[model samples]
Target: MGLAVSGGPDSLALLLLAHAAMPGNIAVLSIDHGLRLEANNEVALVEGICLQLGVPFTGVRVDVGPGNVQAKARDARYAALARWAQEDGVGAIATAHHADDQAETLLMRLARGSGMAGLAGVRSWSSLPNSDIPLIRPLLWARKGELEALVGDAGILAVNDPSNSNRAFDRVRVRDHLAKHDWLDAEALASSAGHLAEGWRALEWYAELDWAEMVAPDPDAAVQPALQYCVNVPRTIQIETVCRIIAELGGRVTRSEAGRAADRLWRGNNASIGGVLAMAGVEKVAKVGVEMRVWRFSPEPPRNAH
Candidate 1:
């Protein structure tokens, strides 16, 4: 496995500790976006650190100057990591994101009226399409404070990324606000998110049961087994069932919208999730079919995946 080293304090601490523990088992992968003049220097610093620790180092430079800087940079960084791992025949890719990042993600998604999936935050492991390789998070249980404290306890200096403090970013907004609340709220929020995720899982489990019994494969949207498998499920389990089916078939679902629509399946005669519209046609056999939302004839695998 490799650590994505940006010279940030938490990542640096993770790198140092991983080296101290695993020794030769781990290496550092640094990507320079060339956004600042000091970017390359930052990579050099991480490389020097790796050399001192007798760990191998590889550096990649990405051109992320167009489109959304943050989004494109993230895409490029992961793409480089995935490419390097594939070439090296590595089993996994490790990132520096910690519990704090997860918490912030949950909060942001919640503020946007996200459902359980968003609140669950990113999973610790992401399975690559048609590959056994996965993106793994070793620091999932660690917090930014713990990682920072590691650096301080070891008497090591780690560079701070100024972009983290900029309020222009939505993450910064959530992070800054999370900076003020008591641990009770933060921990409670996390706990609540966990509960929500559990609920989502349970709902999906029920949906799977329902689908097996009622749904059939569709070849066409207007014909049998044309595009996807169609199910005549009750409004009670519509969105969750749909989301579960989509996920199993390697597709994306809007959790928040879907959850809301599911909640309203009984109250309203019609509800739509991701353009998959459902109307109350029957209740006993749960005869409900989708009309618009998101439907693809065929879906492609995740690009630049592990």
Candidate 2:
């Protein structure tokens, strides 16, 4: 198993506890996002800790481009971790996302008017996007203050990132706001996230069932890559089935787009989304009426007009 240690209180505590529990079987991975000069020194300090503990360590440097630094940095960090785990033949990557972090995440997504899946927040155990490598958050049920106390008890000095307290980020703002309210329960919020995750899993299961029954590839369509769906199901099932078909065709569509497409198709109108054109039509054969909605997906041709 590999542990992603950022030298923070939560992660450092996790590193110490995991090392003690699984001696000679744990490895450490630290990522230097190259965002600040102190990042290098932080990685060095973590590497030194690993060396002192006699654990194998590797440091990876990543470039984070502009626009939403937090989100981009997260994506880059996970991608790097996944690649390293694959190279090292590690099946799971564990990190120190605690109950407080999960509560903050749930609040942040709620502020953004997120759906159930988004409101599920940081999962205790899940896979990275587009990869099968598992991500485990063993300390997810632990509180941040408890972890900090554990670090102090162990006499371990950990590095704190300044950005964590910077109010410029939404997460930091949410964290600060939560700190001011003593009535709010982090454990309750985290438990709510877990319940929402279970609900999301049930929805995915039903979506798969609908996909199998109502959607299929249209091999005989005029377009090269297309999907055919029977619109005789409920509107929710229609949108879910359309989303699955679009993903299978290498096209992307959001929930809003799918809903809009369903509405337009019901009105006998054609809709285009993410390079996929959805057209509704009906054909009669052998005195029987057949209703079919064909969604044709193709890479958009280059356009000179801006």
Candidate 3:
């Protein structure tokens, strides 16, 4: 296992626990996103701690692209970590995402009217972004305060990232609000997120079944393959099924995008989303002896060159 230590209280506590539990079997990996001047110092702190613990440490710098600094930094960090893990033949990577983080994520997504998956928040086990390497959060059930206490007891000084206190970030604002309110139970919220994650898994399973039963190939000899599906399932299932089809057609679509496309198709209108074109039509079902509504999803055609 590889531990992603960021020199923060949570991650440093994670490093301490993982080392205590696994000893020589665990390695430490850190990524400098190049967004903060303090990142190098943080990585150095982690490296120094790793040296004292007789654990191997590797740190790398990554470039974050434009647009959504936090999101891009996260993407770059995971990609770099995945690459490092692969090179080191590490089977899995563990990060310190505690219950407080999960609670904040749930609240953030809820404010945006997110669907089941988003409301589920950060999963305990997932894949690295665009990578098949296993990403595990061992601290998901732990609270942030507990981790900080653990680090404090261990006599380890953790890095305090100034950005964490910046209210300009939505997460920081949500964290501040949670901190100010004693009524809000972050642990309970995290548990709710876990339950939602299970529900989301069940929904995905049902969506797979719906896709197997209701969806079929268009049978048209076009450059891009198309999928046709009859509306036989419930609306939520229908949305999931359409999202799956859009993904299969090489279009990355969110649930909201799928829902909007489904709505347009229900109104006998064509909709385009994430490079996939959805068209609604009616077909005669000889077996049912009635006209059934059907939707076809295909890759959008290329625009004519200017």
Candidate 4:
């Protein structure tokens, strides 16, 4: 396994615990996102510790794309880590994502009016962004204070990132708010996020079943290919089914987009979303002995130039 270390208190404790448990089975990967001048020094701190522990270490530098510095940097970081893992023959990667992070994520998503999936927060086990490499969070159950104490007890000095204290960032703001609230239980909130994740998985499973039963391809194949979905199901199932069709038709649809598209289709109206066009119609279902509402999804055509 590969451990992602940032020389922060949480990740430093992660490195220590993982090395203690797995010994030589793990290697450390530190990504320099090129956003901070202190990033190289932080990576050096992690590297020094890795050397002292007799573990292999690699430092990777990545260029974050324009727009949304934090989001872009995260994407670049994970992409670089995935490439490093592939080259180093690592099967999986682990990161330090503890309960406090999970709680903040849940709160942030909630503030954004997120649905069940988005509100589920960061997953403990997921694939790297745009890659199939397995990513694991072995410290989801641990608290931030606990990890800090662990590093303190071991006499390990962790680097403090300035951005973490900057109120300009949403995460930092949330962290500050969480710190001020003595009544909020971050561990319980993390557990709630876990339960929501389970609910999301259940929704995905049901959506698959609905897709298998109520979806089909347009019979005429000479023109543009389209997917037809029977829309007589429940609203949640309809939204999930439409999401799958939109994704299959080469469009990325978010939960809110799917919900809106499903609503438009339910009213027998045409709607466009995520580069896909959803046209509502009716079909005679011999099996159901009735007329069924249907939605046909196809790629949106290029707009005519005036």
Question: What TM-score goes with each of the models?
Answer: 0.74, 0.89, 0.92, 0.94
The 10-residue segment with the lowest total lDDT in model 2: 283-292
Best by TM-score: 4
For model 1, how does the per-residue alpha-carbon lDDT over 232-285 read when each residue is reduced to its tens digit? 455546666656655554556775565665555445445544434444333232
Q: How many pairs in model 1 have backbone atoms within 3 A of each other, for residues 3 or more apart or on separate chains, i.e. clashes?
A: 13
- Candidate 3 has what TM-score? 0.92
**TM-score computed on alpha carbons, candidate 1:** 0.74
- Candidate 4, residues 1-306: lDDT per residue as tens digits? 899999999999999999999999999999898999999999999999999999999998899999998999899989988999889999899999999999999999999988887987889899998889999999999999999999999999899989899999999999998889978789888999999999888878888899998899977533376888876767877888887888888889887888988888888899999998888989887678889997788888888999
TM-score of predicted model 2? 0.89
Deviating ranges (above 4 Å) for candidate 1: 128-132, 183-185, 203-214, 219-237, 240-306
lDDT of each candidate versus the true structure: 0.69, 0.83, 0.90, 0.89
Q: What are the C-alpha RMSDs, in order, of all predicted structures?
A: 7.1, 3.1, 2.1, 1.7
Residue 118, model 1: lDDT of 69
* Model 4 Cα shift for residue 234 (angstroms): 3.1
Considering only N, C-alpha and C atoms within 3 Å, which residue pairs clash in candidate 4?
A: none
lDDT of 1: 0.69
Q: Which clashing pairs does model 3 show? A: none
lDDT of 2 at 199: 83
When summed lDDT is taken over every stretch of 10 residues in candidate 1, the lowest stretch is 292-301
Alpha-carbon lDDT of model 2: 0.83
